[model samples]
Target chain A: MSRLFVAMGLVLLVGASLSIGVADLWAADIDAGLVMAVSRVPRTVAAVLAGAGLALAGVVVQLSVQNRLVEPSLTGTPEAAMLGLLGITLFAPGSALLVKMGVAAAAALVGTTGFFVLATRVPQRDPILLPLVGLIYGGILGAATLWLAWATDLVQYLGTWTSGEFSGVLRGRYEVLWLIAGLAGLLWLVADRITLLSLGESHARSLGLDYRATRLLGLVIVSLVVAAVVVTVGTLPFVGLVVPNIVSRLRGDNLRTNLPFIAGLGGALILAADVLGRVVRYPYEIPAGTVFSVFGAAAFLWLLNAPRRPAHG
Target chain B: MTFETCNLSITRDGVPVLEGIDLSLPPGGITAIIGPNGAGKSTLLHAMAGLLSPHAGAVRLNGRDLSGIQPGERARSLALLTQDQGVTARLTVADLIAFGRWPHHQGRPGHEDRAAVADAIETFDLGPLAARTLDALSGGQRQRAFVAMAYAQTTPWILLDEPLSALDPRYAHDIMRRLHDLSRTGPDARSVVIVVHDLGVTARFADRVIGLKDGKLFGAGETGDLMTSDWLTRLYDTPMEVAEVGGRKIPFAA
Candidate 1:
């Protein structure tokens, strides 16, 4: 599709998303303008930022690993974030949100680095082995997080980050998510190098890219992006996995050309999930995480079964 | 433009691959590195191109240590196409060739870069297949495109490791002829070093031959002086003979 058409579709989704809510701006008792300014705008932007960030993270992971099956969180980013969150909640008990996010980011870096090392060890055949390893690795971190939460009586707080929902997103609470914009901009600068990485280690290095440094940088970027999303709106499972795959399948894996599409479609998919969640039971809302995974899981299955087109050697 | 290695000893995890490998290569001709398996021919090629750092001694370009050269400058000095040509991603032949211009342009390709890419496409006769992804092409076609990529780099030294190992006779000869022309033509001619199993091509096209045995330099000299039956048999540790066909000496094991 044309860029303009995609832009128009995005604008339409933004408009519809802004308008579809239980509390009407047209209601006499409610100040429509105030409601729109504070709640709707933050929630919508959160969805877009989270979506864009996760999908961008997805492409980075896939390209670096050279495996389509892997995504950001599979490498234990969210579970690591939970571990960070639980640790902070236990020790400080009243740490600032940004400080907590900082801790989460650190743990995420370690977790991601571990996954990267594991990925290098796993031979690149079947491709499914890497993700399965990541899933089990993430599960180990998850078990640790729950054990820590159970011990410290912080299970309820863990619940909040486990289920991704935008209902709690409001003014002044979600400004940290704006960092996604900066991260995305940072990604744009290194997009070309990242694409070269998919050419494999020796090939990219022979072309003068500092291959190890570039791979480490990509994983760090994935860690930071995943940390931000997990901290802001809990975990959205397949936005990172499904969106990039769709964009790559539809277009190609050239990061420069496909990044915007990946980011845009990611935003659109998340917003659609949020809208679907809100409207499905009317006043009673479902978590966007729950909604997307149900559909995202099916999409993942479809992606897995989709006959790989490229006759790769 | 002399390429030389000084007492270069390369070790992987304390196990030596190449030891006391002191040698200098004359510029502006095709040089072939011929050896048995595990003779470290590929390692020497990569080290000469500054892709591998020697555990001892140095690879020098005109007396300057290659290890001290910045990666971008090193890349501009020499282009190395490794033994494995398997690229996981499918990029078009034109785009893949354009990547050789990466060190020059980084991300921004200029007029010169465009001209070089076009020149490579024409020189390799990849015009018909330029728009097609490497995955869609036959093995020989893909190999040609890859060689064209290395050619487009405009480097003085072009190092290839077993580039024609998997090709049929026609494709093999086709590539050898093109590379022979590239290494000998004009003021901008490049020095080509290839790890080759095909002694026929080596004997016909190579100006100098470097023989490797058990990770050390066995012999290095002009093709005519070093490609004799005695040296060939000693280098391979097997009985061998050089047969003359149309005045070309082709070596064969007895």
Candidate 2:
């Protein structure tokens, strides 16, 4: 059934993508079409990769912590990456893109590690409080980024970086996102270990799984994906949180089997949203992140209200 | 394979929970650990299962120090069902049981893994509920499903922490009987160690009984010898009587 949904989604994506480039739609007008198509290709590819990476990261985080509400955004990773980007634009104004990505990746990694430390210190019995604490931590980091960007007279630049738009994702600037696909593959290789860890530390250890190591590895992977996506495009909210849950509802929570579908569906969802943004106002495009936020907020609310099954170990 | 503890001491939150506990469990029979509320029965089970690192002393599995063995290897030797089996997602009965094979097959299950899962389903009479999600089942059925997961682990030792807490009498009896039957048959016969509150069921079904009181071992011997009224009365600090009913020993408060 989910496969059917995905198939329909694919068709919708192709139609939307083609229609968005319809001004140069004819194949015979090769030069004009190539110029338009070539320009859109990198942004489209970056948006899809970001969507897929964020969604996969969200799945890993949710499963590892055994919590539904957590994602790379909620965990303060994107906030930290934003701060890193802000620092680069402020202090090292002439740094190369690779240097900027490095700073952002380091900041994201630190944020993820901080989350792990907080999780260990907080009582495991009360899990709902964990994400709340994480959100507040993220908010603080986001405030710091805002202050820095404003002080440096780069507030508008920071605004564009934080709203999660694919407009800045041009041909040369978007190649960094391919690294996320590699991270997704690595995540797949350890999918079984992550699933076992989801059974909780004690159960996983009893089964001969190195609970702490696997957990840290998962966090590192999440951080890498978040850093890559945030550096390429801004923070796309709830893709990680919503896509995994929707996929799990249709397919069981077996990470190995569901990962590819999660990636495909994630790419499709973000691409469709990006295309929708293009067509919604025609010449002037609404941000894909804004469209995702509206839809994602509704989906998130539905998930919260839906009758849920009791947890098992 | 044998399981034994040597002068084990455990502390939680700066307070000593279990003190100097020592016991040796032989293979292939059901052993019941019975005690009052704060007798540290759960602590003892956790220590034996390697869930908790004892403050002092050690646990030995089949003559090797449990601390020396790798966690994965330890998992293959023993399966522990903790007190609260809280799962956050909706998983089917077969999915839950397949978790048992995690130690053996990790996430990629093989043909033998599926066969073991099937055998576990058949053993626990969960054939009808194979496709049913765990949240959809009753408390008793859920308890049975958890036990089936442990059974699917196919280990030499199975440690259960108060599995009967939320179960009704019939389901409780059914689970105990199933464990009893499984211990006798199967390729690697399991040594079942259960923390039980009901004295009647423990007295009736258990081959051996270990009594604990106030973080200390009160008695360890055959059920027939240790389940007398005087022993139980002293153990719980309440007047009780033990009587034989329908070829099974039962305990009641006087």
Best by DockQ: 1
lDDT score, candidate 1: 0.88
Restricting to chain A, the TM-score for each candidate equals: 0.97, 0.91
What DockQ number belongs to candidate 1? 0.46
Clashing pairs in 1: none
Candidate 2, residues B1-254: lDDT per residue as tens digits?
88899998999998999989899989988999999999999889989998888899889998888889888788889999878766665567898899899888867799999999999999999999998876678888999998999999989999998888888899999999999987777566789999999998898889999999999999999999999999999999999999887877889888
CAPRI accuracy category, model 1 = acceptable
A95-142 per-residue lDDT for model 1 (tens digits)? 888998888888898888888889889988678899999999999999
For TM-score, the strongest prediction is: 1
| Candidate 1: segments with Cα more than 4 A from true spot | A309-313
Error of 1 at B31 (Å): 1.5
DockQ of each: 0.46, 0.43
| lDDT (Cα, tens digit) per residue for candidate 1, span B1-254 | 99999999999899999999989997899999998889999999988878788999999998899999988888898999988854656567888898899989898989999999999999999999998876678888989999999999999999999999779988989998999999989989999999999988899999999999999999999999999899999998899899998888999998
Report the alpha-carbon TM-score of model 1 versus the true structure: 0.95
Supply candidate 1's per-residue lDDT for A149.
Answer: 87
Predicted chain A of candidate 2: TM-score: 0.91
Model 2, A1-313: lDDT tens digits are 7777786887678656655653555567567556555666776778778889999999888887777677888888998988888888778989987788888888888887787677667665665677887899899888988888778888887776778877666678889899988998898899888776667776677777888889989988887788788777888998998999898777667787788888888888888788888888887788889999899989988987894655333
Which residue pairs of candidate 2 clash? A208-B71, A208-B72, A311-B86, A311-B87, A311-B88, A312-B86, A312-B87
